[model samples]
Target: MSLTAPARLGIQLQPQHATYGQIRDAVLRMEDLGVDVVFNWDHFFPLSGDRDGLHFEAWTMLGAWAEQTERVEFGTLVNCNSYRNADLQADMARTLDHISAKGGDTGRFIFGTGSGWFERDYDEYGYEFGTVGSRLDDLAEALPRVKARWAKLNPGPTREIPIMIGGQGEQKTLRLVAEHADIWHSFVRPDAIAHKLDVLARWGERVGRDVSEITVSNELSRGRLDDDHADALYDAGVRLFTLGISGPDYDDAPVQHWLAWRDRRNDAVGVDAA
Candidate 1:
């Protein structure tokens, strides 16, 4: 947002209320529209509309995404840590990294993950719906395992896949971000972002790793990106802005509007120098 790096637009194309073919078509359209990343949530059922609406799984769909598009990075908006073995998650992510690599170029994968939430996913999938503290502790422990596994992987990840951790829990989440995250994604309000970053910096100090280079990413709710608050968000150092789109419709008008807004903000960088 400071023009130190141009703002990147990402979309969480919600995988519900439509067929897989519809979802695949929408992905290609998003890539054609030039969004930087495309994300899907790691949920077992629809998060909106009918409780049992037509929905799809996350990782398997991602396997298709790697081959469906030649550009645009893709991953879960935040994978549920409780859903799979930590080492298995690492292997799946690494496999995606290799699958997306084409034309002899680096892979297009962002390992965006989080401590599991959505009890229904756990309940239905037979995973232990543990307490919040336990879940966070599991994530804290799993992060290191995920990294260790990458090193032992055969034909290791083509690139050190960027880790994007979601959530702003002041204690565990932020500390995890301090130690491992390359991108810290949150939905914090404009007024709250500065404080969150301050807390993050404190954690960075405690962990003894400079957190200044970590990309600050924020999500914009449907139709919210044009608000004056976006100025506050940019001023707060948010460089990646993501919005969510749902299936059946996959209405991209909001995405188009935000992309235009992204261009205007980026163009100002040149104007400032001129």
Candidate 2:
């Protein structure tokens, strides 16, 4: 792990327990506040609070975000690979990539995805609630199909659409990250990042791939975003710090605080936050 990338702040504006209007406004506010990337989770039910609370689909909202936002890169924090066909997923990403480009030099979509979890989403939606190993097996089978579909699309992706893979499973997940990911995200604490990176490096070595190019990401815990924790993660080679914000009000205060921290860290590291 090397601290070569600029520090960046991302917000996962959870699209649960809030109306679409509130979610949209939050996205605009985050970009206005100079957040580097914006994200939404792919879930049918609220992950917190009320289980049956108001919730929205991830991909459709991302489509809207593509048309709505101008500067900030955006995507699902981790899309459920089981929810859609692999080729369709690739095409949807390609379409969003083009839409977000708005005739710019590059697109603003990051294709962050993972093996599906959450049994409720699968059972209620009539998808098979298979074992974790089975789900990961499915994901391993799907990613190459996604890339092949991207190659066959009518108008290819605006740029090489960055693939972001999330999760901390050292076996299958890290192996997939080594093979396919441009960015690797996990929720492990700062102290645990080194072990995960070591596992990821081993996977990279086994696959004959150099994963040093993959940007390291971790969640920003509000209580723990102090100088020590941030510094530890930075020293461990993490560059992207994401905060998950739930909705109804979609508070921006915490995001603002993290943005300030991001700028300070980037400046200290001699990398531009912009």
Give the local distance difference test score of model 1: 0.90
lDDT of 1 by residue, 172-232 (tens): 8999999999999999998898899999999999999999889999987665556566777
- The candidate that wins on lDDT is 2
lDDT of each: 0.90, 0.90
Residues 1-274, candidate 2, lDDT per residue (tens digit)? 4576799998999999999999999999998999999999998999999999999999999999999999999999999999999999999999999889876558899999999889999999999989999999999999999999999999999889999999999889999999999999988888888889899999999999999999999887664547677778777888888888898988877887888888888778688866
Q: Count the backbone clashes (under 3 Å) in each candidate.
A: 0, 0
Question: In the order shown, what is each candidate's alpha-carbon RMSD?
Answer: 2.3, 1.2
lDDT of 1 at 199: 93
Our model 2 lands, by Cα RMSD against the true structure, at 1.2
Clashes of 1: 0
- Identify the leading candidate in terms of TM-score: 2
Candidate 2, poorest ten consecutive residues by summed lDDT: 221-230
Off by over 4 Å in 2: 222-225
Instruction: Supply the TM-score for candidate 1.
Output: 0.96
Q: Enumerate residue pairs that collide in model 2.
A: none
What candidate 1 gets wrong by more than 4 Å, as runs, is 1-3, 223-225, 271-274
